[model samples]
Target: MSLRTRFTEELKAAMRAGDSARVSTLRMITAKLKDTDIAARKAPTDPGVSEEQIVAMLRAMAKSRAESVALYRQGNREELAAKEEAEIAVIESFLPQQLDEAAMAAAIDAAVAETGAASIKDMGKVMAALKAKHAAVLDMAKAGPMVKARLGG
Candidate 1:
């Protein structure tokens, strides 16, 4: 099934299961996606967001919750931090499996080679290639510095 269809099905399941946390997180995702769709509608010729875009949106939501977790922990709000952690778990359930250290390194190297990135000046090209190929699983934040280091030295 498409990501959007899966999200809808999962939302209904969560509602039936009375899983409030999952329900809320899924609702938030749907809302965000709907908002994106509405925004894109302004451009009549523009294709609606793709499955990859949906995955990127979900990753962004999870990253936001991760940030919230850090802030809650720093403020000594253990309960809130735990709640954010739970939300992250629910959000990630829909995302692809993330790459580990070794896999990430191999992917980066492959991207660099594929893009023929020879120096730091070509970092953007390499990063773009990696993001295109692995948007669902690669952590761009971590990959950026790794790509830069690989190209710089």
Candidate 2:
């Protein structure tokens, strides 16, 4: 199912099941998607955001909430942290299962090999290859440093 369709179906199910937290999180995601689509419409010839872009947005949302969870915990706000964690769970439901360390290392190795990347200067090519193949499953923020180190940066 398309992410948009899944979101609608999940939202309805949440509403039916009286899952208030899930309902709220799903609504927030749709709202964000709407806003993103509107922003993308600025270019007359541009289509709105693609599914990949939507996944990227969801990842960003989850990452932001994770940061909030950390900050909330540091501030001794357990309730707030828990709320953020719940939101992260909801957001991640639509994302592919993340690669574990070993899988990620293998993916990076494959990208490096595919790109014939030998030096730090080829970091961009390797990263681009990884992104093209694993944008949803890989966390580029973590991958950046790993790729850099692998390329002798």
Candidate 3:
């Protein structure tokens, strides 16, 4: 199923299950998607945001909430931190499973090989290849250091 359809169905299910946090989070996602769709409509031929874009959006949302979690913790607001964490969990439920260390390393190796990345200068090529193939699963922030090290940076 398309990510949008899944979100809609899941939202209904969350509502049926009386999951207030999940319902709220999913509603936020839908709102974000609607805004994205409207922005995409500037080009008449645009088909709206793709699945990859949706996943990217979700990832951004999760990252923002994670930062909120950190800030809340630093401010000694455990309750707010926990709430942000809960929202992150709900957002992540729609994302693909993240690659573990070994898998991520393998993916990076494959991307490097595929791109024939010879040095740190080729890091952009390698990273682009990885993003094209593993945008949803790989954490680019963590992958950057590994990619640099592998390229002898």
Candidate 4:
């Protein structure tokens, strides 16, 4: 099913099951998606956003919550940290499974080879190749340092 449709169905189910946290998280996702769509509507002829853009937005939402979780924990706010963690879980449910360390390494190696990226100067090209092939599953934050190290930066 389309991600938008899945979100709507899951939202309804959460409402029916009285899952307050899930319902709230789902509502927040839908609202953010609506805002993103609106922002993309520069002209009547424009399609608001593509599925890939929606996935990117979801990833951003999850990443933001992850950062919030870390900050809350550092501040000794266990309750808030747990809340953010829960939101991250909800957001990640819609994302593709993330690559583990081994898979990530392999992907980076392949990207480097694919782009003929032999040095740190070619990091951007390698990164672009990885993004093109694995945008949904790859964590660019983690991948950046790995790529740099691989290139002997």
Superposing all C-alpha atoms, what RMSD in Å does each candidate have to the true structure? Answer: 2.1, 1.8, 1.4, 1.3
Clashing pairs in 4: none
User: Model 4: per-residue lDDT, tens digit, 1-153?
Assistant: 999999999999999999999999999999999899999898878766889999999988988998898899999999999999999999999998989999999999999999998889999999999999999899999999999999999
**Which pairs of residues collide in candidate 1?**
none
How far residue 3's Cα lies from its native spot in candidate 4, in Å, is 0.6
Global lDDT scores for all candidate models: 0.89, 0.94, 0.94, 0.95
TM-score of 3: 0.93
Candidate 1 lands at a TM-score of 0.88
Greater TM-score among 1 and 3 belongs to: 3
Candidate 1 per-residue C-alpha lDDT over 1-153 given as tens digits, one digit per residue, 9 for 90 to 100: 888888899999999999998899888888999888877686777667988878888888888999999999999999999988988898888899989989999999999999998999999899899988887889999999899889985
Please list the residue runs of candidate 3 whose C-alpha ends up more than 4 Å from where it truly belongs after superposition. Answer: 43-46
After superposition, the stretches of candidate 4 with alpha carbons farther than 4 Å from their true spots are 45-47
Please identify which of the two predictions, 3 or 4, would achieve the higher lDDT against the true structure. 4
Q: What's the lDDT for candidate 2?
A: 0.94
* Ten contiguous residues with the weakest lDDT in model 1: 39-48
